[model samples]
Target chain A: MRRRRKGSVVTEILTWVVVVIAILWVLFPFYWTVITSFKKPADVFRLSSIPWLQFTPTLSNWQTEFTQRGPEILRGITNSIIIAVFASLIAVALGTLAGYGLARYKYVKWRNQSMAFWFLSQRFLPPAATVIPFFLLMKSLGLLDTRVALILVNTTFAMPFAVLIMKDMFRELPVELEEAALVDGCSRWEAFLRIALPLAAPALVATVIICFSFAWNEFLFALVLTYKKATPMTIIIAGTEHTQGVQFWYVSTRLLLAILPPTLLALTVQRYIVRGLTMGAVKG
Target chain B: MRRRLREKGNAFVIPAIFWVLTFTIFPLVYSFRVSLSKVLYGKLVGFAGASNYLRMFGDYRFWGTLRFTLVLVLISVCATTAIGLGLAIVFNRKMKGLRAFRSILTMPLFTAPVALGYLGVMMFYEENGPINVLLKYLGMGKVPWLSHPLWATLAICLVDIWQWTPFAFIILLAGLQSISDEIYEAAVIDTSSGWAVFRHITLPLLSPVLGTVIMLRMVDAFKAFDIPFSLTSGGPGTATRTLTFYIYTQGLRNFDLGYASAMAYFLLAITMIIGLLFFRRYRELYE
Candidate 1:
């Protein structure tokens, strides 16, 4: 009995050790980025140093990023916001209806299955493969370098994943409410809008956040589609370099700004992240 | 009544289908068209037939970069899966502060890969960086991380593992948490050793999720671009350029749209094959 208890105690200690390591490994880079953003430019590249300590904190990087590179950075941020929000809205709006259709209705044999596969498989389509065609198509439409082009392309990529997620969301919801609403002389559309939509609100929020993050972080499409007019935050962050050197401080500021929205949204919707990420394959 | 219901369902679905199809299906055909021709300055200049593909197959850099990408995918996917599973298993046990611990652990998935790439630059810096600093404290010499070929690959892999392990962990943890306590209780009684119970029961039950997670990671790893693109820029003389980066440079930089489209199609084929395999396994799991 004593040996067994000792064994468990060892296991317990080991478990906590592993957990601590995982947490530190995950958070350290983010913490480092945050601190590096606050440090002065000289302090950033100081030889043989620790982050978050032994360095004078200054807002100079932020000041410079805002003042010197302000227009471009702000433009990137604005573009990112506009694109992510519109793309997410478009994806969510279209995806919810498709999801409901897939969830509640039976189509011809294998039809639903094939449609779901088509939707889910969009995630597998290499953006590299699709970018050239999108570029040419957008150019033909005379929409290159416009936010609308980004919005449309982002929607295309985001909608399929959004559909699958909302499908799963709708699948989990019981049909009794909608049935009763229909029985009470409500049309199917009205029942859907009044009853099902309200219940699926949380899942909708999760879908929106996921779509928003995907659009915001998308790089290659943004890179190829928009040269100047709609260059999003990711491009701006990637383009942050000076002739002198790495410009660690300025880059850190850009990194911090770029990651803030997705990080906050992911944390708030932590419960739904696995669901959204896996396209609702494994429910969180 | 069924006909009306079907009509309604089609109504609800057709609009989205049209939207996604325009992007995916049209691009696929357009890409294939471009792949079969010579695209010069964004125009189809001549009929290349299989020449673009023939050229790609013959190019030594294409084969070399592909081999490099496959190697990186194998290393990173395996590392991420192993680490993710290990962390999940450890955290699966009931413990103090588990919720808070998990919340912190998942932040990396939220951060963009490009951001992580930049962060990797700072963290993996040869001089005055944290990793080297810690190594120096341990009486070890600094290793050239991103400057050398093999070291650059390893550096990129480390960053990939750091960013993606949480994604795997989250999926596996959800898988783990879904297992009933009763199953473990029964297994514990049947086997005197913990390892025996795990090897026989826990692993078998978890294999499905593990397989799915591995396939997902593999697909993403195969198409890895942002990390190498931002971190090394496929640096040290094309040593770190993966297939996607290669394609990007060919299409975007070199203006060889036809050749780039062919390469991208080749990549798409690889991704599709994996996706099909995954779909088969996923169908088995579900149906």
Candidate 2:
């Protein structure tokens, strides 16, 4: 049975090796980006070099990137934050009410259909399709370069998703609370504010995180819609002159800058990441 | 009471519908009309009447870009789904540090796509990018990255795989976790081979989730624009030009609105057909 033991041992070793390789392959780009960002152009592209552990790290890239390009990047970051946060708040506010109305009332034929329609329509077009009309509409409003433009556009896209999740949460809440609240002097709005909204807190938290991230990470709209005033960090990074070669200590540091706030916010609310995960897991 | 409810419903949705009507649906129809019009003095002049559609028929760039997009989408979708499924299974087993590992794996999904695109260029460009450096360190020769069509596509695809495979993993793992423990115990008692049990039980049961994830990723990959747009800009003689990229080129960048509209409409039509097919198949899964 020595050969049998050998075979199983080999199998186990092979599995571990495969897993390690796969994980490396998955992380190659990010790891490579992080590593290269610390290296000078010469070391970054050398014909003979080790990966990661040994290198003459440089702060030159970061110094140039943030010191010279700081304000531009900051504007974009601010725009992204403003757009993502405010838009999601607006979306959550409207969606929460709509969700409860549908969940509680139930008989309206239009409610389910409209919600589904909005959900599908909100996401169906790659921002590519809408970019044109969205641009035109933004131009008409003279809101093109303002963070307000992003807020409006992002809210349009975010509302349906926010509504879908909130509806699901509301559906799970027993109807008696709402009925009792309504029976009291509380208007439907008061009942909604006083009762349902609190109950749906978890879903709302998830909705806000998800929507905010979509706005924050959004590339196309920011690229096209806001050339100057509302440009996000994503667009600034996309600029060819700003992003080049391996002398990128500054880029990744700046990248870390833009990434950190959202990352911290995300980690802080990571409890809701389950809602984020499960949202896409089950259909609304 | 119900009437009050109806009024409440109207109150919440009216603002949202107004936003969509003003921005989204309105512009969609308006753009269609303009697509049918001819540009005269930087303004729409005449109704083209399928001329825009006909123009796309002969546009080699549009077709070439479309073919490239299909290849990118097909490969990325299959690759992400296969790798994601494998990872999900591995992590599904009782394991050490799975939670922490999962959080790490998902970090890329949170990185903005535009930053990821720039990250790709810095990491893959021939002279200073680290891939070639590592290659040479291992005694391999350096290869040009951005200057060539094939490597550019590969680079973009790698970035997507890094950024998005977590999405597939999350969905599939959720599916796997939802399967009850009893089913596995039954299979174990039957003395069934693990592979057979997986093929017969796990695979079939996971089909709905698997199907949805695949369809979602495929559509997502198909419509992918930012990575290819930012990294390659459909460069190296239009080798990496995707259909969506072509739309941006023709419409926004080049100001060829008529042709771009036709291309956009065609993309919408294709995605709708595929999306509807998946939506119908999985309707039961949701309801």
Candidate 3:
């Protein structure tokens, strides 16, 4: 008993040590970024980490970004918001219908399982493979360097994720409820919208959050698809280098801008994130 | 009634099917054709029958980048999974402030990889970056993080691990949670040593989740571009250039569409093979 008690105490202390380390590892970069954004150009090269104590905090970088480079920054933010929002909305809408179809009905030519797998497989295709083709397709359609081009690309990529999550969610839901609604003299579409869709509200919200976050943070597509007018915040952040070198001060501020929306969205739907990320593989 | 329902359901899938046919299937087929044809400045000049594919075999840069990519994927995936699993195991027990801890830890998952790469530039800066600064405070020498080839690769992997470890942790933690307390209790009763119980109970039960998290991380790591692009710029003489980065440069920057298309198809082939193998193993494990 005494030996076991001693061992447990040791394990408890070790566990807390690991926990503290994990927390610091995760938060330190974010902390550094936030603090760095507040520092002046010279102070950025200083060894000061603590705000005000090690060095006086200034908003020169943020001010310069807003006043001097405001239009460019605003354009990126607007494009990112428009693209992410539309892409997620379209993906979730189409995915929910297809998900319900796969869950409710049987197809003879291509089995539901195969169709669902087809959607999942699309997610595995390296974006590199399709990027050239997508660029060509967009260019041919006169959609290059446009927000519409990005929205179309982002929607296609995010749709598979939405389809997979909603498919699993719809499959797990009890079918009897929809069946009972059908027997109550409701049309199939009516039963779906009134009963099935409402019942899957939590999953719908989760899918939307995940899809939106994915589209918001997408970089490669934005980098290739847009030039000036439709540039997303991601492209703006990555292009923070000047002739001298990378302007770390400006990059820090821009990163905070690009990171804010998706981070907030993820926090709001924290519970469903694991499920959405894993495609409902593990029920978080 | 059944026939009517089937038709309605099939109609519901039309929009999704149409979108896929236009965006995915059409693009893939076009890419294949582009891979087979010679293109100059994004315009098809002539037919190049497997010459682009044949050129890759002679290209030393292609071989070097391929080797570096495989190494990066292997090391980063393994390191992320190990650290994530370690953290999950340690935090699996009931503890105060666990939810807050989890929320904070997983924040990286939602942030843009490109943004994180930019953050990495500051965090890993040699002269006065936080990491080197801390090492200096501890009376240690500052390592040249971005200048040296090997160290640059390590820096990229470190950033990748930092961003992705949370993903592996959450999934594995959920996997851990799903394993009932009864099994652990039963195992503890049979063995006095904690290691024995963990080995006998926890690992076996967690294998399926482990397999899944590894596969997901592998695929993501294989397509690594943003971090390398923003962090190192594939610097120290292309030491950190990924295959995707190579494809991006060839296709977009150099306008070598045919060669880039061929490389892209090569990447797709590799990804598909890995995915198929994983699925086969997954089916066997479940069935």
Highest-scoring model, lDDT: 3
| Residue range A1-284, candidate 2, lDDT tens digits | 11123366665565566567766765666566556556686765453234545677677767776788778877877877788999999988877776666665533656555455555554555666677777767777787788888888788778777766776688788767878987877887788788888888877887888788777877777777878877877776666334463445556665665555555456544445544543433542
Candidate 1 chain B minimal-lDDT segment of 10 residues: B1-10
Residues B1-287, candidate 3: write the lDDT tens digits.
23345565777777887897789888999999999999976799889999999999999999988998998999889998999999898778776777778888889999999988889889899988889988898998988999999999999999999999999999999999899877877777787877787787789999888888888888888888999998988988899999999999999999999999999999999888878866665543211
Per-residue alpha-carbon lDDT of model 3 for A1-284, expressed as tens digits? 11144477787788779889999898888898899889888888977889989988997888998998999899999999999999999999999998888877877787776787677677578999999999988888999899999999999998888877787777778887888888999998998899989989988987888899999999998999888889999998877764327677888888899998999788888877777776655677
Which runs of model 3 end up more than 4 angstroms from their true locations?
A1-6, B1-7, B283-287
Q: How close is candidate 1 to the true structure, as a TM-score?
A: 0.96
Which is the better candidate, 2 or 3, if ranked by TM-score? Answer: 3
Native interface contacts retained, candidate 3? 0.67
TM-scores vs. true structure, each candidate: 0.96, 0.90, 0.96
Candidate 1, which segments miss by more than 4 Å at Cα?
A: A1-6, A47-53, A242-244, B1-5, B284-287
Q: Is candidate 1 or candidate 2 better by TM-score?
A: 1
Per-residue lDDT for A261 in model 1? 90
In model 2, the Cα lDDT at residue B86 comes to 86
